[model samples]
Target: MRRPVLATLIAAAAASALLAGCGAPAAGDAASAAGTEPGSATTPAVAGEITVLAAASLTEAFTTLGRQFEAAHPGASITFSFGPSSGLATQITEGAPVDVFASASTATMDDVVAAGAAAAPAVFADNVMEIAVPASNPAGVTALADLARPEVKVALCQPAVPCGAGAASVLAAAGLTVTPVTLEADVKATLTKVVLGEVDAGVVYATDVLAAGDTVTGIEIPADVNAATSYPIASLAASKNPHLAKAFVDYVLSGDGASVLTAAGFRRP
Candidate 1:
């Protein structure tokens, strides 16, 4: 009887050991199944998409900055909407799903702020007007005065845009008034007219001229007569991704982003 009882006890112990071996995972298996290494510190994932509405003048610089921002914050993406600052402001006011707004002029940003579409906007950069002419300079436009030539076809941004207002100010400061053949919607459109030879000359932002490279020749406007437009950036109040929007605004104001903008001919504000 004692022998039989001992054998039964040994059999029970063996069965319990087999169950334990089957239930427990092998070393490192637990971590692998959990999608992390053993003893590794966990980090919060940074992921989301934010849409930004920016002025046309900021196209090149902002595009570069947006790429850098995405690289720095893995899993984050940015979609940009570029147009005249005034048009962008109106879009935001009309309930556009924009996470951020970067304007070519403070006045345009003020409009968004006044409409409760954006919060306190910070001036990020400044840009001045430059005379953009075709590479061939068909109308022989070499200075601000040259744009007044009767035969010269000049293009200027619409008055509703910051570029247009700046152009008006520069022309006013020079005491010169010349009718434009076309009123473009934005600085890029004005530059395009000059680049495509649709117009002999255009008044556009200095940055736009720089972005055009050799496609268009830029005649520097006299500092005294040139109108400097202050660029302001802010996260919109209607942002779906408020945190990501604010992060993008902060990134734009960072040193790395400033370096990119400065390289693109934007002056530090």
Candidate 2:
């Protein structure tokens, strides 16, 4: 009787131990399942697609920066819509789905801000007006005054665009009044007219001339009469991914972005 009772007690003790072991996983297994130990530092995942509305003048530089930004933030992507800043601002006000807004002029950005579509913007860069002519130099445009020649078929951006405003300011300062053969919607279009030889010359941003490379020749504008346009960037208030939108804006203001902008002939703000 004593031996039977002792065997029963031993079996009960073994069963209890087995049950306790089954209640919890091994330490290594627990750590592996969690993918991190307690108190460990982990980076938050940044993954999403953002749409950026940028000025036509930023086409080259922003495209390069967008690629670099995607490379840095794995699983993140950027889509760009490039056009006149005024047009973009209008779109944003009308409920366009844009994550970021980068304008070539503060006035254009101000309109977005006034519409409550964007927050207070930060100036990212500045650009000055330059005269772009066909490589053939059809009108023999060598100076700013050459654009004022009656025979020169000059293409200028529409008055609503930043490039046009800058051109107007510069012309006003130089005390020159000459009608343009064509008024383009944006700087890129103005540059295109010169590239296609449709116009003798076009007033465009300095960066636009650099972006054209050998396609067009750039004539420097004298500092005394030249006008600079400020580029401002902001995260739209209606952004679906607000955090990512702000991050992209920060990236543009970062040192790496500055290097890219400088390489494309933009002046740092």
Candidate 3:
């Protein structure tokens, strides 16, 4: 009887040990169950504020991307300064405390990189010149050649701006020369002239015309005569929040960013 009682106690102890071993998970097993590999480093949550200086032509797309980035990164925020690429590049080179720079042309980006303000900019989009006119079609501008007519009052971005350079290239390709009535500082300002009927037509980006919706009508530039500029984005070297700045640049090169840009009529590079 004593032996049987001892055996029963031993059996009960054995069963309890088995149950404990099967029920409790090991540290590595717990990590696996949570869909993480054991001993692997996890990405830290992005948190901080960044200032982005972008080309005026990228206003609509970049604004939408900025909102999406803020939504995805709850603790992160972005402030944007949109203007001519050349001016924005100058600001970065002049120590404006910018976090990121997205220029409408490679040449403008090169200026920042040359100044050591940025590095290895990625070209994300390309834009072509187009003729933006008021919805009323007051000038009856139908083709690129119409912009050359003596009676047509045209607005253009300043020569230093990407839109102006593109317009110049397009006109040169078509062998048409017509001076602009107004030389605006940025693409948006030039577009405004067309939208407000202050000018019969404005030489701006195709994306600008699309963003204008019904307020302006776009006359397509022939592919052979059209000029396109590549957009490059980079994290500035003097960023106070370097990590956040790089994250923002990465976000702009992401698929989600491409979608917003495409919706805004920017062609993927």
- Candidate 1 global lDDT: 0.90
Pairs with backbone N, CA or C atoms under 3 Å apart (clashes), candidate 2:
none
Per-residue lDDT tens digits for candidate 3, residues 1-269, read 35688889999999999999999988789777764577652533477898999999999999999999999989999999999999988888889989999999999899899999999999999888899999999989999999999999999989888998998999999999988899999999999988889999999999999999999999999999999999999998899988888998999999988998999998999
* Clashes in predicted model 3: 0
Model 2 earns a TM-score of 0.85
Off by over 4 Å in 3: 1-44
Q: Tell me which of candidates 1 and 3 scores higher on lDDT.
A: 3
Model 2, position 16, has a per-residue lDDT of: 97
lDDT of each: 0.90, 0.92, 0.91
Q: Which lDDT tens digits does candidate 1 get at residues 1-269?
A: 36688899999999999998999987577766765566652522345998999999999999999999999888799999999999999989999899999999898888888999888899999989999899999888889998887899999999989999999999999999899999999988889888999999999988889999999998999998989989999998888888788889999999998999999999998
Worst 10-residue lDDT window for candidate 3 reads: 36-45
Q: lDDT tens string, model 2, 1-269? A: 36698899999999999998998877766765665454442423456989999999999999999999999988788999999999999999999899999999999999999998887799999999999999999779999998788999999999999999999999999999979999999999999999999999999999999999999999999999999999999999888888678889999999999999999999998
TM-score of each: 0.84, 0.85, 0.86
Top-scoring candidate (TM-score): 3
The stretch of ten residues in a row with the least summed lDDT in candidate 2 is 36-45
